[model samples]
Target: MLDARREDLGRMLRAWRMARDPGLLPGPVPFRGHRSYLTQLDMALLLGVSERWYRALERGEDRTYAREMIAGVVRILDLSPRQATALYRGTGHQPPRHRAGGARPDAALLDLLHQQRRVSWICDQAWDVVAANTVAARHCPWLMHPETNTMTWAFSAEARYQLREWDTKWAVPLLGQLRLAWQRWPDNERLDEVVRTVRREPGVAELWEDTTGVRGDADDAARPMYFPLVAPDPLDVRVATYGRFGDTALRWVVLSPVDPSVVFP
Candidate 1:
């Protein structure tokens, strides 16, 4: 906390409290204080903290506070993202992400995807295809499928037809990355389901158990792709992956067009 800005934090908190209209809220509610603004006692009870602790936080006093207590205030106050971030900073802590908020496709990330002229899409930590731009949807049809788990698609027979040397080029590297992700976030339900789903595919269970192709991400090497399809596909594509959105740990997969000399499927 900036010592000079202590009173600044207090003033902001009081102002925010006054600005909040309790009448607009739904569900069983606590009685409002004078002039219908929430009181320190009401805030304390809503935040599940002691009245003394709540008073200290309101005044931005020099006492330590738990992250949950601060997060509770954010939830109860219904702070905007900017306000939540400022509150966390004022308390000398980085803002906590709403875990479920990261689950939905981020609009800013979707904007980033469409900004690319090349084929591009974004996936969350579990490799669930959250958003793919028009080019990506057109070029990599699998991305737009209702079942857009990359692991499931990579292990399926469709991948064999789409990718040249599927086992060595695509499956190996992809499985390695999925395995590493599962190891890092073993409890992630969607990722676990992806693991189970891919294993159900023929020979994939054996592949999952092997120690080979233990890569963290895709390499820049040009790989052949083919689409015997309903529409025209991009010519000579190379895979490039970028990790953006450190908070959500979202990955951007770009298919950059290369010279025609790239290997044919």
Candidate 2:
């Protein structure tokens, strides 16, 4: 079993290295020592480890590296959330805890966000805004705030002032989604704090108390909501959610405008 796991990890590491874009490499030098794509030497330099050590791991000759080393490799490779978790498990190590401070969108998700013309953002289990595209930030400036959080922003006075039909269109559905997140990550302290903070609002506590299931699945249809920041007109948008493969706590949210004519400044 151990040998099989090591071989599998080695295969995955090779695949990731081969698939990596040379442009993603840091610094002006794209490749290390005249190699195309990411070479073992480049990964070693990036991780501050010796080439032999990195090569050993890639060859499945050694599977005794520390967790921190594995983490460094994850960062250097720009591994997806799922890939990071898999790396931990395949190496006989427990996966790291999901927390606000450690939440980050992987390279693929970041690339997708940059390519999207529609409003899109990524959030963690705590609903903390980890990343957003230009369109999302431009249309919804609040999403770019340093302390942006979906639950807090939804219940804030600013949101109430900015959104039309805040109660039916935004607040209710948000509460349901928060309830789902809380259920999935009940022990996450940041989420606990978020729930406590939101429960202090006028009717939000009651709504949260009544919310029992997840209502924000990928298939959940979008509802109409007016953004005063854009204009007085209502923009119909669909909110689609996607879960990262191994990291169920991270979500990708895309707000696709129903009308193709709508464009953000």
Candidate 3:
């Protein structure tokens, strides 16, 4: 099975190499009168590795791989973000994080939040509330704060009281997301701080460590919630998260009532 994976990656790499634009190749083009597609020798020279080593990777031989080796391949080939991610994952390594949460959402994107009458907010890759509609603000007061991180707030002591089935239903899935995010953006200080803060809280560390609990998102079931407005009654909501094609930093988190008859302020 492992051998099959390696062969598949080798073939994929060859295909991407074939598809590369000839004009993008760095250094002088190889001497056999270049038409299209860089030779393995060209790739080896540019990657600063021996021709034999590069061949092993391309031929799916059992050879040790280095992070920088793959990084060099990415640069030399000018791989797209998606392509780069595929390469890293293929090599059984975590891809370096991109600047997904760095840019502020443009006016048009922010307008989306303002236009929504539902309990909706926009969060960055770090899960910081970039913008929130009035309806969302009423339910999550922390969103009004300029620097509020939704992830941090959600993992806080107070969240236990508001989020129903806080452990299995909510925390488990969310922790999975947190783990993946941090793995991608290992250098993100804010995300690092959030992990630390949550780990320090009693029992949270245990939850974070439960590998079985890691999930991609926290919306598989209705998130039973409680708030002053819904006092004595649970405000069940279905969560949905959205992201644009090229915008990695922008995520739209919306909550719709489980019962269509329910409406938000």
Q: Extract clashing residue pairs from model 3.
A: 100-249
Model 3: residues >4 Å from true position, as ranges?
1-101
lDDT of each prediction vs. the true structure?
Answer: 0.67, 0.72, 0.72
Which candidate order results from sorting by lDDT in descending order?
A: 3, 2, 1
Q: Give the TM-score of candidate 3.
A: 0.59
Candidate 2 lDDT at 146 equals 43
Q: Which stretches of candidate 2 lie above 4 Å from their native place?
A: 1-101, 210-219, 228-231
Question: What TM value does model 1 have?
Answer: 0.54
Better of 1 and 3 by lDDT: 3
Poorest 10 consecutive residues by lDDT, candidate 1: 23-32
What is the per-residue lDDT of model 1 for residues 1-265, given as tens digits with 9 covering 90 to 100?
5365866887798788777655432111346444557778877765567888888877878777777777656644557778878888888888854332234334455566666766677777877665666666555766754326677887889878777777777777778888888888876777887888888999887777774657746667667676444225534457888875365467788876566343322
lDDT (Cα, 0-100) at 225 in candidate 1: 73
